[model samples]
Target: MNNQHETPEQKRERLRQEELKKNPIGTLKDGFNGNGNLADLVGSLGWKGTGILIVVLIVGYVFYKLFF
Candidate 1:
């Protein structure tokens, strides 16, 4: 077995190549679509919906504090 240490530039290049493999089109395409329409399939009971719920809660709390 042999151990090798990569220079900073070499390590960065390797990481960039790995990122390209994971997202060739950059951020335009959603890679997780292989499973299906994640939103419809998983329903609205997920982090997406939960995030909206949290925003609403925060706004409501602010309004309550401001008005009453």
Candidate 2:
């Protein structure tokens, strides 16, 4: 085992290289291409629906407090 200490910049650059390798396109789009229907794409992801549900619940609670 080896204990190597790297500077902050060095560590950042190393992580950047790893991410570039994972995403060669070098963009934050998550590899989704254009021309695809936005609703279909979002609906395909289960977590997105759950997140929207949570937001709706929070807003409903806030509105309830404001009105009642």
Q: How do the predictions measure up, each by TM-score?
A: 0.35, 0.34
List ranges where model 1 is wrong by over 4 Å.
Answer: 1-44
lDDT of model 2 at residue 4? 69
For all candidates, the clash counts are 0, 0
Q: What is the lDDT of candidate 2?
A: 0.58
Reference-based TM-score, model 2 = 0.34
Considering every candidate listed, which one attains the maximal lDDT? 2
* Predicted candidate 1 versus true structure: per-residue lDDT over 4-66, tens digit per residue: 678777887676556655654432233345533443322323467558867998999999999
- For model 2 the local lDDT of residue 63 reads 100
Q: What C-alpha lDDT, on a 0 to 100 scale, does residue 29 get in candidate 2?
A: 41
**CA lDDT of each candidate?**
0.55, 0.58
Model 2 misplaced regions, further than 4 Å: 1-45
